[model samples]
Target: MTESKKARSPRKILIFVVAMLLLSGSLRLGSVGIAIASSPEDTEPSTEDGATLECVTDAETQELMALLRERSDRVAEVEATQAQRQKDLVQAEAELLENLNKLEDAETRLAATIQRVDGASSDDVSRLTSVYESMKPKDAALLFEQMNPEFAAGFLAEMSPSAAAGILSGLTAEKAYAISVVLAGRNANAPKI
Candidate 1:
């Protein structure tokens, strides 16, 4: 029984050592196998849609480059449009300012012409009023009869009240009434505001 126990113990120790050596060797071989499998030279030819990995990578790179170029061109075109629009806006602003300046100049000249016309007409009215004042009322009424109704009304408006009254009294009733109506309605168009 002692010899049997001694033989079993040695056998168990040898088997354990052998199993440990086998496990270490297998682990080493597995790591080597993984390394070889991962290497480009030892790896299987991997394909997608019948194209190699390198070819797929190159195609993807080319598509990305084309997309980037298209985007870049679009950006450039947008920038150019913006630049042109800015230039057009500046020109339009300048033209508007120039037109405004021209308008102001025209308005100023028109105002001066109106002032001259007003001054001359008023001077003519004053001279005519004096001429009418110097004449007999009956003679002035004759001239007023020959005058346009609106024109005579304007002369009467500039005259003194007593002179206007004398002229109105001398005029025919129908003519006097029309002139009076024109004077009355002159301020009818005034704005309430």
Candidate 2:
């Protein structure tokens, strides 16, 4: 029994040593495989046998770069055009404002002239009558025809009745009819004032 136990103990030690050596070898081989697989040198271009590898950009990448450049240029052009248009719009607004100011000034001057004429005519009934008498009948009639009926009526009343009648008689038939209608309307709607 002692002899048999000694023999089995030696066999077991030998098997354990062999298993340890196999495990160590397997770990070393696995580490080597990992190192080789992850090495940058393995993926680098090799210089051998007079063969050279050139890396070139793909067509799609080049086309994408060209399109980006074109888009940038178009954006720049649009910005420039918009800036120019804004400048033109500002200039046009300034010109329009200037024209409007000129128009306002002109209107003011015209109103002042009209007021002066009205003042001169209203302040002097004698002068108004003399001017009316001096003018040709036809011219006076035409001028009176264009005046407001109320104003014409007032001016006619201020004139001598004979002079007023003469002018009325000299007026065209249409002018006479319009004046008669205005006069009749005024009489019909006479106020207490």
Candidate 3:
């Protein structure tokens, strides 16, 4: 019984030592795996010669970079186009303002010319009226007889009441009636207020 116990102790001792060696070896392997996973150098793939090679960018990364560059280019293009449009708008506005100023100057000149013409025409009408007034009523009536009733009425309106009466007296009844009608109706459309 003593010999059997001694033999069993030696076997158990050997098995324990083997089990402890296996556990320690497995623990060392696990710690080495963790160290390799944490290190940046060990994360990269090595060539057949054991030399770590530089990683080429993946297709997705390259595509993303290209997209970003394209977007940047588009943004720059849009900004440039907007700037050109703004500049064109400013130029157009300036041209319109200049044209407006020129138009205003032309209008001023036209108004002055119109005023001069109107003054000259008014003076001519007054001179003609004076000339007719100085002539014999019979001669003036002859001239008025050939004139349109409305035109004669216009001249009569500019004359003194006595001068108009003298011209009307010299005119034929029908002609005088037509002239009188024109003169009377001229103010018909005027506001009474």
Per-structure clash totals for the candidates: 0, 0, 0
The lDDT values for all models are: 0.90, 0.82, 0.93
List the pairs of residues colliding in candidate 1: none
State the displacement of the C-alpha of residue 4, model 3, in Å, after optimal TM-score superposition: 61
Tally clashing residue pairs in candidate 3: 0
| Candidate 3 lDDT by residue in tens digits, 1-193 | 7999999999999999999999999999999999887878646677999998776679878998999999999999999999999999999999999999999999999999999999999999888988888888889999999999999998899988889889899999999999999999999999999
- Against the hidden reference, what TM-scores do the models get? 0.66, 0.46, 0.70
- TM-score pick, better of 1 and 2: 1
Q: Which lDDT tens digits does candidate 2 get at residues 13-116?
A: 99999999999999999999998878776364547875666555798789989999999999999999999999999999999999999999999999999999
**Tens digit of lDDT per residue, candidate 1, span 14-49?**
999999999999999999999887788844455777
What's the alpha carbon RMSD for model 1? 9.0
Worst 10 residues of 1 by lDDT: 46-55
Residue 51 error for model 2, in Å?
Answer: 35
Candidate 1 segments whose C-alpha is farther than 4 A from its true place = 1-56, 188-193
